[model samples]
Target: MTLPTTAAAPPSAPPRTFSAVLVANRGEIACRVIRTLKEMGIRSVAVYSDADKDAKHVALADTAVAIGGTAPAESYLKIDAIIDACRRSGAEAVHPGYGFLSENVEFAKALDAAGITFIGPGIGAIEVMGDKIRSKNHVMAYDVPCVPGIAKPGLTDQDLIEAASDVGFPLLIKPSAGGGGKGMHVVEQAEDLASTLLTARRVAASAFGDDTLFLERLIRAPRHIEVQVLADNHGNVIHLGERECSLQRRHQKVIEEAPSALFESLADGAAHRERIGEAACNAARSVNYSGAGTVEFLVSDEHPDEFFFMEMNTRLQVEHPVTELVTGIDLVEWQVRIAAGEVLTVAQSDVVLQGHAVEARVYAEVPERNFMPSMGRIVALAEHGAADATVSGQQPDHANVRIDSAMRDTLQITGDYDPMLAKVIAWGEGRTAALDTLDAALGRYTLLGVDTNVEYLRLLINDSDVRAGHLDTGLIERKLPSMEFRHAGPRELIAAALTLWLERPGSAFAGDAWKVPDAWRVGARGAWTATFGLPGAGTATVSVTEKDGSVTAAVDGGGPVNVRVADRSGTGLVLEFDGGLVTYAVGSAPGAVREISVGNDGWSCRLEVLDRAERLRRMLSGIQREEGAADPEVRSPMPGTVVSVSVSDGDSVEEGQVLLAVEAMKMEHQLVASVAGTVHLTSKPGDLVKADQILATIHVHVATEETANTGQNTDKEVHP
Candidate 1:
């Protein structure tokens, strides 16, 4: 089949300030670049993978080019394809947006050789700073306070243990060429050193194509701070203050803010700022850095005066918006100007940091379920911003909120890329105001269909420790597991139940119906189950019961809920039966699912029929009743690739033993044995398994008939 195109011959006009720019990225960042281009009156060109044909960024660009396959390696990282895209789109420059080929020096060199301007630091700077070991050596040469560690690579397990001992207990074993905490492990004692090193090396090899690792003395309760720097080709550099990124989980930053409170405690704030700023400048100068970059430091809270250079990101960071908000400087514009042979517009002394800014990344992940990446369609996204805020009249400039997002009401959150859906930022004159604004915005922002960490973010912003600015890299790890998954209030639960009930099949309110029989049953009220199409992009089942003339419903899927409905009489239904009042509006038809539009919170629920709902329930009931069965079967929880199988047929295993390991979405999970019995494994390593697939079975030995019956009853209770 011939592909459709609106191709035209190249323009005959001479180049007018970068006629076009090729965005060598995807998703929000690509969209961000295109927005900047449009502001500068430059045409924007977008490149897409096979999977991103319908992505938001592609539709937003002036022109789009399809590169290759869905995966990063096959498309975004393919230098030749990117260069070809630039040529096809008549783009005079290429912008590598923070990932894929952003830090790849070879790609920069290739762009230079192809005579296309790369809108970032030059190839030399990228080469120097891309290698962590080399960058460490370069920074240390300038008397920067470097982390206490060695830069050598390829150390044996014994050497690693000895290095850890010298660095002291609780040191970090990190890959020599790593960032984003990949291939890094924390060793609490000498005994854990060897295993941690091996794991780190393996992970590093797979991720960065380097198995070399290094040791660093982990600073106890260290807060992560990074200074944003912009430099021109004409030997001028300025620091844009610091961002405090202490709230992180598994070495990934979830929240970031500007002008840390810890900075205020230092005796000589100006002097300390100058010193750190100078160090960051020197580090940038070491690589002859130009354009926008961030120099990260791990500052010790115990010894507030002391700080060590962590690493330098050669590209714009994911959390650069907070800096932009407080400084009122567009880093992207500067990057474009610098690449076009422009001199520095602002001097170091001219730069002034003002106000407080906080940014929270809203990711498609379940905070209650190990922060696992979630993927699906964003049925509804309600983003709270200054444009939608109420005027409080307290501060003249207190609009306070900003949302940077690429998702719309019907966007799909695919599993093929990063799970971050949006970045929400709040700016205020003081820290308290910023924190309060951020918390309130989070509370008002509503998302449906996929799981997100919105509630978790709210918890963090409200926590006494976070509010008081007592933050560190380990804060989330120390507090998150206990904080997440706590029950939502009864009101929220009732709202979810009502949402489910309204979306059930045969419910008089199935469509956009305004009225239903006063006491009409929605479905088969006896253990009835019907799927509900949620606003976000998935279907969930609602089990309804109608015993003793009372209606009861339970939602059988994850994520939050917001339901609103009204009756034909124009009276809003105050669904207060489930401990909360779910305000709803009546619709014209039963097919018109309940939709809730509160401020920026937009969500809807559609009723659907589930063919297997009844069958599954019957199967579960039958399994529960067969309590004295001789053999018990085990099933898979989710679809995944089996990474390992530890047991074979006839292998005796204790309860809670790991029977197999399955990998899904780059993370590993173990399937544990639920009973102490002889294992009969049905699947082996490297097999792809589906949810509820019988992976294994176990047989329990019983001494007597009575004891067997008792054990069977116990098994049924435990499994159920």
Candidate 2:
């Protein structure tokens, strides 16, 4: 789809030249924006919170300014702090890179009042399109197709309920004020509409400060497709084609690509693209949109030709690199050029879709555990770029792959923000080639000392339906049951024990006398053993025997297998084991933390070497616990702030009852009681809890020996 190069221009004004620009964001996006500013010879200014003082973006900028505290509200979300930094650094323009305050109308207004340029759309556009309800209603007037239902600025619960019949069953209730799938509910019957609407409104008011609600017919097996449109102050707009974003979990996109494979599957694929692309341009034109924007749509997987308007993002997208790769256009550069009052030099016809591009978002999460966010210091970091690129914090635009990241060696990944670590984008002559490159790139991507979904992403891309382009919103959920997730195996256990054992003092003679009295025999070395606890997979004993500079190891008392370290480097291990040579990526916790991370062939795990006391505690627990009983203690899945506590101390609860909720990395996880019993609370609402910290405990009664004969139950106390 192409934009007509004819429209009324804005009032003629003096061209503005920007010598310095401030990136009002953090992480990979901040680094990405800075790269373009550097290439354009514009001095880049970066702002940081206390947590980000040593961040890669701060180091890459010519000058860095400290804004405020560590949390987003105290720093990144503070408009005044950012504006002050812009003034202090003499930054003439500010680029709000995607998240924080990118589409904030108030921020844009303040910048305009301060005579500073905003490298994005006009105030009117952001103000209107920022609201989901307003954008949906507003776009329809411009010949944009919309999901059928009721959309009004001030629709009350009664108003929506009255219109529910016409909107039909299986409708969706969405908060008009915010995105991210928050405050959205799907109602299958009219009877359930009222209560769901109430919940939606409350969430909307709390999350977005607006209680506005709207209803839309829930499209069955929907595919998320977004179009990248570029518009200037001169009313000229051109599209860069469409991207398929259906592969998601918890309503967050995991994989994205352009041009859409979903669209390409249609009988009239090119015509469908033209229609959707033109609609996207119309949506932008309706708001007089400027700079780079993405118009997202919901297309039915069952019917590929039809698309309904979703929402308009008035800033750069996280998946913008794929659009850039396929079209050979740098969106950031054009954003700057458009902000500087430059006219559109590239016409609609000139926009050619070249090759194919796919992007995978890298998140610090454990996919097997419901995508739980993981946090740790980056003991090791490697990406699809030269080793130096990680240190420089530059966007790596390789021949086939482009990496957008702010990761560096020793960086602390905290739960104070979103868990997205980076993005890996790959390009090729076709979708298959592009996907192959992406899978290979992800395999080489190494970020240790923390759990990540790298291995899960590999499995996802290789899925048969995914490879066949049979994508839908429900695909990931339906496929989750059959997905075989990897964990720490015998080989992993050997590596973990060997890593710690070799680094210990006097390893040649180190052995517990009582446990292995024969370890000191003259003919053979005594067996040295270390206990390691694997994440989710329980514990194991790895015994290593060394004689004459040769090493042999066994896990869980299995037969000894020959093993030797061929080479060792920073986070790199080359080992000859069981007649095979392999390169394994590894990381260890600093100091006496006793944790080690090992990975090879994209499957990785962080295992902890338990001390004597912890190992004994586990052994005692195994001996005392009842058969087939769930653990009494409920642990927080990740480090987060307690958001709610449903059960109070001494409250009787049923199995699987929600006890509390913890919010970490912008996601909320509910902790549940594992058994029917009296509940005891540990952490309350607003209390910060660490990962695996016990938040509550359910005390179930056990029958005593004498009571068992009479069928009487008694309580016994246990403490952490």
Best by lDDT: 2
lDDT of 2 by residue, 1-720 (tens): 444753444446655669999999999999988988888899999999999999999999999999999999899989999899999999999999987899889999999999999999999999899988888878889999899888887777889999999989899988777765666788999899897786567557755667888889988889999999999888789888899999988778899999999877777888888888899998998989999999999998777777899999999988888888788888898999899998767777777788788889999998888888899888777886532232122344545877888999889899998899999888889999999988998998888888888888899999999999999887998888889987777777888877776665455325444453335566766788888887974789999888888888999999888988877776787788767988888888874546888987767788887889999988888778766768998998888898778878999899988898888887778788888878989888889988789988888855567777876655554432
- The per-prediction CA RMSD against the true structure, in angstroms, equals 9.0, 3.9
Sliding window of 10 residues with minimal summed lDDT for model 1: 1-10
Instruction: Give the per-residue lDDT of model 1 (tens digit) for 630-669.
Output: 3366776545667678777788798888888765554556
Instruction: State every prediction's TM-score relative to the real structure.
Output: 0.80, 0.92
* lDDT, residue 6, candidate 1: 16
What's the true lDDT of residue 182 in model 2?
Answer: 60
Supply candidate 1's per-residue lDDT for 437: 83
lDDT of 1 at 358: 91
How big is the RMSD of model 1?
9.0
